[model samples]
Target chain A: MVGLLDYFRSAAGAQKGSASVAKERLQILVAHDRAARGRPSYLPKLEQEILAVIRKYVEVDTDAVSVTYEQEESHEILELNIVLPESSARS
Target chain B: MVGLLDYFRSAAGAQKGSASVAKERLQILVAHDRAARGRPSYLPKLEQEILAVIRKYVEVDTDAVSVTYEQEESHEILELNIVLPESSARS
Candidate 1:
């Protein structure tokens, strides 16, 4: 009887696993659609320009600058983040 | 007269400045509308969860983590950036 119950539990777990897989696939599809439809044309150039501007002031890796554009319901936020390396000059 | 020409030039400059100002206002309005319409409900929670997960291993400032969600043509990118403080242990 224990063996039989274990088999049923395994079957239910497998079903739940497949349901999660389907959900993941659907999310990917929706994300792809949104990407194709709504991305701004200026984003890449804007990021590059921002990186260049920051480079004028500090020595940083190419990856140290990040620019993100997010659209919100009442406003769009263009966020720029720069990670500066700790200066050895500081005691 | 040079003064008369200067006055006309100033008038033209004012008009141009006002045109740029109007453009800025329109951009702000459009941003507001987009912000109001389409931000994902899960974004803030997702950011907080990510920050918590990272904090378990490393000590970091609250502002040191940035989460950005960007949709592209073929994929959606959820970017998490963490600025780690320079470890004094490192030579």
Candidate 2:
């Protein structure tokens, strides 16, 4: 099946793990990093969008859904965390 | 076969995308981030190690290999780029 590995293979070709590809990836990652330095005005909109996506399946603590990015040594990750309330019945 | 997917699945089970996981990942990524902020005195040693790995395969421009860290938003990337000379014979 076509997946991330396939994409990487097609993207890198014979120059897999080349310096140029690394630099390009870094440039993109850094650009996103710089944009998210502060709380930023669009944070609310983003949060709402995430909440909406989660709300579609089940009720959840809106505040519990957090969307963030993370990077470490060539690993650029988009992290999403959501928490739902206990299954107890509401009074 | 055991791959990254297996590793990630094992690492995060029911709380695969939970905020706590996000925070943990961020902590680890950021630690690496802060450590790489400066050129760091050990850069030369790292370069030598990397050059040695590449040298095992082909002769390359020792100066061409560059290692750098980039941070964006929540993305931290370890970027490594190397350039090699052409195949032309030396005079």
Candidate 3:
């Protein structure tokens, strides 16, 4: 069976954590902190949809990604650090 | 200059992390997840007060020691693992 580290090192693991952190964090904050590394955005409706997808397909820890956004000189980017649940890592 | 590990080893640091995590998580979550590890609770009023105090004195990262609650066989407990910012720790 594939384990977490093995998958995290793989290509898919890297990108996914960044993207999902935003989603997980937002849901957590009762519709707040919808920041993708300081992006200007809001979408409860879209977020709900995404949550649906995340829930159905992935068993995200919400703990691992613990996403947060930051403001830099000019650009906005998504920052996430999700650790895939060992179970999810397999599929 | 004492760093995180030094303080964490101290008694104060250990207890505070668990308690603060509950506070930090709820605020960001937009009035959500106020669980003392499965205990019955709804604390918007108290929470706001705590936030006021916390913001006043400490520069809480609101990042590290991300708090969460858990449900067990018969009891509820708060779970927090806050990482004190270097600047704040100095004071």
> Which predicted model would earn the best DockQ?
3
Score each candidate by Cα lDDT.
Answer: 0.31, 0.32, 0.31
TM for every model, in the order presented, reads 0.25, 0.22, 0.24
Top-down lDDT ranking: 2, 1, 3
Q: Is the docking of candidate 1 incorrect, acceptable, medium or high quality?
A: incorrect
Off by over 4 Å in 2: A1-91, B1-47, B71-76, B88-91
Instruction: List ranges where model 1 is wrong by over 4 Å.
Output: A1-43, A72-74, A88-91, B1-23, B26-91
In angstroms, the error of model 3 at A65 is 38
Runs in model 3 deviating more than 4 A are: A1-91, B1-39, B43-52, B89-91
lDDT of 2 by residue, B1-91 (tens): 1132333333334343443322211101110111122223222333344345334433456465445544333223343444434431122
lDDT minimum window of 10 residues, candidate 1 chain B:
B24-33
Q: Write model 2 residue lDDT over A1-91, tens digit each, in one string.
A: 1132332233334343343322111111110111122222222333344344334434556465444544333233343444434431122
Candidate 1, residues A2-66: lDDT per residue as tens digits? 12222322333444434322211101000000112233333334345434433443445656544
Query: What TM-score does candidate 3 get on C-alpha atoms?
Result: 0.24
Query: Which of candidates 2 and 3 is the stronger one according to lDDT?
Result: 2
Residue lDDT tens for model 3, B23-50? 2111222211111234333233323333
Tell how far residue A5 is off in model 2, in angstroms: 18
Q: State candidate 1's DockQ.
A: 0.02
